[model samples]
Structures are given as structure tokens and as C-alpha cells.
Target: MVVVIPKKRRDGKSSFLKLVFYLSFREDNPGDIPVTADAFFDRPSTSKIAVFDRLIDYIDRHASPESQHLITHLPDGSHRILCEGVLCQTNTLSIETASSEMNAVALKNTRCKDPVYHFFLSWPETDSPTVEQIFESARHSLKALGMSDHQYVTAIHRDTDHLHCHVAANRIHPVTYKVADDAYDISKLHKASREMELKYGWTRTNGCHVINENNRIVRSCSKEKSMPDDAKKLEYYSDQESLYGYAVRECRPEISEILKADSIYWERIHAVLIRAGLELKKKDRGLAIYDRVHPEQTPFKASSLHPQLTLSKLVPRIGEFENAPRVMEFKNEQGEVTLTNYMVSSHYDDRLHLRDHQARMTRRLERAEAREELKLRYQTDKKEAKCPSFDAKNRFRTLSMTFRFRRAHVCVAVRDPLMRKLAWHVLAFEREKAMAELRLKLKEERAHWYRAPENRRLSYRVWVEQQALKGDKAAISQLRGWAYQAKRDERTAYLSDTVIECAVSDDIAPVELKGYTHHIHRDGVILYKKEGVTQMIDRGETIEMARPFENEGDNMVAGLHLAEQKSGEKRVFSGPREYVEKACSLVRDLNEMGETSLTLTDSLQQKRVCEIRPQDKPAPISFDSPNLTP
Candidate 1:
């Protein structure tokens, strides 16, 4: 048995006294009452009195029921009868002037800051004393708490399964004219209740024990009571359950569809709950749904009903719904960009996703432009070169070869030499620019490898590799642990790029000839083959050659190889056809004049080559050249 001091809740627009009186005595509005009633068993007495003796008699009559006799023990070892019988009367407390007098006392003690000492004395419904015993126990407990000199009333309510009493004691003592402080009253009541239980021979229940769901003490049987027959229970059933069972069941298909699609909002669940006579209300800790008819009952947690209704689950869905506006960027044929919708929703993630999508679209658009540029360059080069177009042999291929040969020959007389040279120069510049970008990207990739994550160790694997080289045992262990993550990390691996390298082949034409393959290797080397010699001409100054030679008639097969030092490495020079022809003519003149025995020094050859440098180089001398005989 526990004398529970429930927090007093004021009735709407009611004074303190009136609210307390209504809580202890009313029957019309259940919300006003402090305690629920199970059944009206008996009203032993009812009266309206202000006289001291009359108040005592009123209590005497109310405490003694017809079915139970009241016995009081005196200090002189004598016993007396305290009450008579039950009285059938109307609600006397509701019509009494006690409220007004209490109100007057309350007004007189305006300085008093205490609240009405209003509380309930509840017992377990299954095992409790009779009404007379409960009334006597409450009276004795209230007096022991220093409320004996105060005007108070006790209403025994049996409307609930438990037999309980509602006590509304005025805090301002009428005689002492002093305000009462009932701060320690709860501790006194607990002690008194324990003594009363032993004195009255009732079942002893523990106090300040069992905790309810709200972390408050379960002071009464009311906290443990099951739902009334008329009140609805929220239960998961295959057929029907809860007040809004039909609506809840109706949402199954929508839930399935939403889950399958993984989209939309939680509006379907909200609508379902609303249709089922339930509403979602915010609590301090979470969200709960309650039945309209029985809101006083324990509410069903939204999460308890279903996994989908949890706060975490609903946040993203609700966020998506609340932020459902799409803003897209469209480009006109004139290349002007415009937003499809001028207004967008005020959600950060929505704007972020939109920005990401637009960026991807822009990248795709750039790639398309790059492809178009490549096609346009191909067409322009073909138009610039005056090469013969053949349907079987590609016109683009013929144009490309002629343009490359004219550019590579450096001094050759070919149709539209300047335009072909410009075309070749632009292609080389573009390739070099592309290679520079790739190199920069590769450098960034190497930096990214150092920042790659380790295996669940919150460190970088690059540091571990450094430690492993120093033979640190811990670093070795860390390295082993980090290896798995390193393998998993795509960034840690070497990212490859298209690098520029010179390619050598025998099928290509020589620098002097114009036919077949005509692509310059990325290293700026032009490879060409003519007669029995294959030539590799490097841009700027140097050239190299590989050949087989034979003596024809009086012409000597003297293979004079000259090497020039570039960056401390010797590079061979392959002569232009005109220069070679001039050199051969000079040599033939020397031999005819019988000057074969003359010493040929580097200075003499350099002077002669400088003299012929002003003339534009001609194509390679074929076997049919007028100056050559086979």
C-alpha cells in the first residue's frame, strides 16, 4: 500500500480550490478527477457544515459503512463505536460552501506560495482493505503529516479496480494562520502507510519499488491495469486489430510498392494512421500514435508498430518528400545555358545532387565537342593539301601523307607547303598539349597514393611502407595489416597514361619521299624509307640512317658517317636529297680532277655545306635523276 502524491493538474479555467474539490468529488467529467473509479459501492454520510463538531460527525458518518463497524481504541483502555450506517445522499461536497471558505482562506494567505496538498491513497486492487479501513488509514496518515488542524475532505472512489481515496487538504492552517510546508509529507506517509498496513492487517506492498515505462514509480495497480473492454488495443493481427485496423491493413499494398520502388514519402503511413482514427503526436523522446476514444491509455509507439515508422527510417523519406523540386539546366543551339525552372526547393542535398548531375552532363557535352573538333581537323587538312583523291585509297590518307611529308622534308617544294606545314604544326602542338595534361594528371595520382587509407588502422599505408623499409617490427605488422587495404584501394595503384615514345618501323617512307605512312611519333621523330635506306629524322637538327650500299661503276661506296654531339651523345645526320646530290657532284668533280688524294677536313666540308644552305631542299634523288647512273 502506497500513499501516492500525484502532481495536481488544474482543470480548465478553474480556481485552485475548485479544481482540487472537483478532483476529489466530481463524477461528470472524468478528466477533472484525480483518480479513476471502478464502481460506487456506498456513501456512508453526506453533509454541509462549517462548525467544528459538525465536521467531526460528518467524517464519523462517512467512515462507517452499514456493512462494516468502526471501532476506536482510547488512551484509557476503553473502546468506542465511531460510526453508524451508510447514508443514501446526493453529492454533498459538490454543493457545500467548503470551496468558498477554502478559497477565502487561500485569499487571506496570499503570501503563501505552497500548492494544495492534493493526492491519492491507492492500494492493489487484487488485495486491499475495505472502504472504512481505507478512510481511517487516510485520516490517520494525513494528521500524522501535520494536516490535523487544516480543513480537508476525503472521497473514496471505487470506480477503478483499486479502492482509493482522494484527499484535498488546504495548506493554510485555519487556526495557526500559518502556511504548511508538506515537503517531507511523502516520506511520513510511506512510514504511516507501513504502520497502517500492520495495524489494519492488510496485505503489505512495497513502496518506491517497481518502475513504470516513464521511469516513475508504479505506485498503484492502475499503472499495471489492462485496457478496458471498450478501449481499443494496438495489436498486430492477420484479420483485424486496433481502432483503425481497416486503414492500417489498407496501407500494406502501398507500403510494398514504396519499399520496392524505394522512393516517395512517408505520407502514406501518415494518411493510414489518420484514417484509422489515430494521429501521430510528438513526445519528448519519440513519436507515438494514440486512439481518439482512449487517449488516456498508453500510446502505441510509431516505431513499435513497424520498422518503417521509426524516426531514423522516416527522416530520409520525409526529407525527400519535403524537397521534391527538380531544377535542370538546358543549353540552346546558340550555346546559351538556361535553367528549366527558375525556382528551386530550399534543400541543400537536392541542390547538391542537381549540381552533380549538371556537371556530369557538361563533361559529356565537352567530350562530344572534342570528337567534333577531331573530325573538323581531318576535313580541313584534306582540303588544304592538293593531293590526288582516289576512291579506293582514302582521300584523307593521301592528304595526311602529303601534308606530313611536306612538313617533315622542311625544305621540299610541295603544293601548299605553308598550309600543310601549319596543319602539321597544329597537330604536333595539340599532341604535346595532351601529353602535358596527362603528365600532370599522373603526378596528382602519385600524390593520391600517399593519402590512401590503411586497413582499419586510421593511418596511411604509405607511411607503413616507409617504416617497413627501416625494418620496424611494428611497422612490419602494420604493413601486413595495411597490405589488404592497399590492394583494395584503387588510388594506391599506379594510374597509367598515354606517354609519348618514338616508334621505329621499316615500312615508312624516307624524309625525301611522299607515300604510304606519314604519322610523326610522339617523340617528334619522322620515319621514312626510300631505296635501300631507312631514315629517322628528328625535329630541330638531327637525323639517323640505316642502309646497305654497293659500288656502281666509278662512284665510290665510301660510307662516311658524321656524328654531332647533342647533350654529350653523338647523333648522326641524314642529308637532304639536294645536299647529298651537291656533295656527290663536288666529289665527282674532285675525282675527275684527280683530287682523290686531297685531305677532307671537317672545316672544309662545313664551309661547302653552308654555301648550299640558302637553296630550298629538293626531294630524294631517285635512280632516274639526271645526275645519277645505275
Candidate 2:
């Protein structure tokens, strides 16, 4: 099933560039495998802006050896750059340039509180699509949401079992500078997901919007039978079966059977509900079912469960709306007061146990850390008390004396009219300095207290993340489930690992090439990166290149020289016509100058090398490009 999730930042501090970086890089350990695919759509005239430069530098910095830590699984010197492309950009701007333009356009519109619209399109573990398919899906989905003209950055990640795509789009138009309409966005997304599932032959999942009998998209529930917004949220976040859902799934059929009696009454309905550990109660002029154990929770509306269970329908059939008897007369076959006990869900017990265990561990660790911190604080206080310069009592006495002297001076000056003004000004200046010092000291102390390790308690979410990093499969599953839940919340983007494995050769020793930062994977796959250039040398069998710009042939040639030097063999050169011609020219010049023995073959002479192509052109631009005059 395909899930479309729109993410929003409740704090109103979202940034386009920040979202781009997050989607394109790993958060747990920044130096590991980065983006699997990165692309841009609907950008401005040029990409040679300052923002693009900064982005390139940022990527290069992270890929450097200095960023690697022990936790990084890659070899000590290697870094990986998977793939990057550009689509529907004016002037055919690069992804970096397009992202920079997106941020600039967003900054121009101050009225729009959130200019960046972030969302995710995810598929289940059973379905896996190629990189091309992911890009195609993103384009189709964005067009469905009326965002074909918006500037956006998309990246595909493969860190988890399921493959997902992240699209960070600018809400403000480039030329019009108006915010895009987002009304009924969830409905639009549901319709889009349904379309994709049908087109791609994917498994279908339940949603609020569905295709109707007329073959047109429509909402599934009527206004009266629709679920409350709060109940929907509860179902999304908890993941466990909600009380309302439990009633409909387990009790609705039995209630229907009871209503088929020859002469129905309130007692029969009550007895059936009582056996199922549920009770029917009057709720705001309507009948609702509440779980016997969780009376405080939200109840399921009778009409929402089944039409026959509604108060209007039940009252007409059973004579009047009579309340269930309060006597202890109902009993199940087991002679127990209740049977078929209601549970949140089958997994509730496991979730509860995990939650309790985590809480206990957190509390124990916090207590131990707190005691150690207290001991250290007490020792520090003792040392400070011993030092006369750090004595609190002396400082208090000095402050008191200063205050008294200032007040006495002011009083004396007030008696002499000429000197009163001068004395008051001097006293005020001294008082301001003293207050400033006190405020600064207080700020420093507060900061130190908050920054202390012992003062920062671990939350359940953070604890789960820590465990997942430690390779706990259960923790990983829980974390992934949380991501699925957040699809309904739509408040944050979820990212997983993006590690890719490449073939490695054991015969060749590592070679350090000039002007390129070398990143070696744990399995001996070496990646070389420079400005506007990315080349991967997996042992000796294959040479891969990432060309995100129009003109970087010199850098590519330099990388190829290094690859040939390390491999000690002649490699075929195959790519687009332009790149092939350029490689031939450069290699010929080098061989003639006696600098190297290099050979080149064009696409016509040999089979073409796989090339990373831009996505199909997006729908026509919504706004005209701004005309520039010099």
C-alpha cells in the first residue's frame, strides 16, 4: 500500500534548506551513506547563487575524513554519494542551485507563516521500486496536489525495510509569490494514493476518501456517521485498537443478532452488551457504547457502528428508550459477571510491558546519575566556600553596603538642590552596573544547570532511538511503527539509513588521489569526491560517476586517471555524446603529451554507459518567469 503523508512543523520554524539537508543526509551518523536519489523541480533562472555554493561545501565537508567517527561503518577514508538529478528547472539549473532558489523565494513572502511544505510518499515492505519509479511516483503525486509549479527538492531513502521518498516543496510561487491553496489536502492525497495503487498494482488500504459507485472520488462516511476528529487522532497515534474500533469489530454483529428477537426490549440488548464487557449509555440524545474497564475513554457512537443500533431506530422497535437495569442479574456460561473481556488490542500487553520496562530503566539510571551529580555539586560548593574570593556571604555583605551608601548619598544630595541631580545620576549609573552583573550571573547559573547531563531526562522516544542505534530489532520495529503513526499526525519527516553495498576487489591496495577526498567503505569500496565531481571505484571491476552539473569533464577525467592508475588496466569510456567526445579529446591530448597512456571509445564505437537522466518535464509553469533587464 502507498501512504501519502503531509508533514507540518507546529512550532512554525520550518526552513526550506534545512528540510533539504535533512532529506538528503543521514541524521543518526551524518558521515554514513547519504541520499540514494536527490532531484529538483520548477526552479528560477540561474543556480550560481551563494546558497548553492554553501550547499556544495556542506556536502563536501560532511564527506571529509574529519567527519568520520568510530560508529561509522564505512572504511576510515571513504565517503559515498548515491545519485542526484534535476527536473523541470528553468535554465536547467542544478539541484543545489534549485534548492537555493526555493529558499530565496520563500524568504520573499513574509506573510505566509510556513513557506515550506514537507511530505512523504511511502510503500510497504512487500513493494520495492527502482530509483526511476520512485521519481516518477513523486512527480505524479505532486501534480495531483496542484504543486507542479512549486519549487521542491525530492530525495529517496533506503535506510529501512520500506523505501520512501521525501519531497520538500515551497508553498510560495517563484514569480507570483503567492501561497498555494492547500484546502482538503488530505483528501487530494488519498485520491492520489488510490490512483497510484491502481496504476502500479499495489495493495489497497482503507482511507477516508474512496472511489464511489459513479467512479468518482468521494468521502466514504456521511456527516452523522463520521468519526470525531479527536478519535481519528487517537487511532493514528496509539496504533492499538481504539475503544470505538473494538466495539464495531467485536460487538456490532452480536448486537445485530440480539435485535432480531421476536419481541425485543432493552434488557436483551443490555444482557448481550454486558456479556461482551460493554455497556450502552445515553450520550447527548443518542446511544453509545463504552468499555466497562475504560469508562473514562471516548465511547463509540451507536449510529457510527450500525444503523439499527441508533437510538431513533431502537426506540421505535423496543417501544421506548429505557435504561438498562442496575441489578446484578446478567451472567455468562462461566458464571462470571462478564465474558469476552474487552482489550485495547492483542499487542497491548506487549506494548505495556515494554513501556514499563523502559520507564523503570530510565528512572533507575536517572536516580544514580542524580546522586553522583549531587555529590560532585556538594564537593564543588565546599571548595568554593573555602576560597575567600568565592565566599557568598562576603559578596552579599558588599552588595548591602553599596546599596546603603548609594541611598545615603542620594538623600544628602536631595537636601542640596544643585548637587541633587548630579548625585542621582551617579547613583543610577552604579545601580544599573550592579543589576547587570547580577542578571548575567543568574543567566550563567541557569544555563549551567540546564546543560548538566543529569538534568536532561531521557524520553521514551529518545530511548527508543538509542536502542535502535544499538542494533535492537525490537526497537527498530517500534521506531518504524512510530513513523507510520506520524503519517496521520503529519508533523515531522522520518528518515532511515541509506547504506548501499558495492563490489570490492581484494587485490588492489588503497590509492590516494590528489584533489579528491577518498572515502573507503568497510568492504573496501572506495569513493572519490571533489567539487562538482563524484566517482566510485569498487575494487577494480566498475567505475561509477555522479554528474549533477553540465560542465565537469575535467574533474571526471582527473578521477578516471586516478582510477586507471590504481586499477592498472585500460577501462572503457562510455556515456552521452558530449561526455564521450570530451573524454576522447582530453585523453588524446594527454597521450600525445607523453603524460599518460589512455584510450577512449565513443558511444557509437561501444555500447553506451548508463546515464542518469532528468525526470520528464513537469506540467507547464503556473506563473511566468520574471523578465530581467540589465
Report, for every candidate in turn, its global Cα lDDT versus the true structure.
0.43, 0.54
Task: Give the number of the best model, judged by lDDT.
Answer: 2
Give the per-residue lDDT of model 2 (tens digit) for 27-52: 33221232121211222322345444
- Once fitted onto the true fold, the runs of candidate 2 whose alpha carbons sit more than 4 angstroms away are 7-22, 25-100, 103-118, 159-161, 171-188, 208-228, 235-242, 245-250, 256-265, 291-300, 315-319, 329-394, 402-630
Q: What is the lDDT of residue 117 in candidate 2?
A: 81
Collision pairs in model 2: 75-521, 77-519, 77-520, 78-519, 78-520, 79-519, 159-497
lDDT of 1 by residue, 1-630 (tens): 767785554642224445433443422312111111121123223323323333344446553355334344434232222222221111113213455666667667767655467777888756667655876776777777887657665666655546676767777877666887777777678767777766765666665333345534345442222333322322311111343332234344554456456565655555545444455666665666665445764565555444465566667656632321233558899887655443222111111111112233343343334434534644564465442222423633554566466556644544586876776677677656655665566567655653444211212333333333343333333322222222122111111111111111111112223421222321222333334333323222233333312223111112221111112122121245433444444443554457542223344443554443334434555889788998
Off by over 4 Å in 1: 9-26, 29-95, 209-630
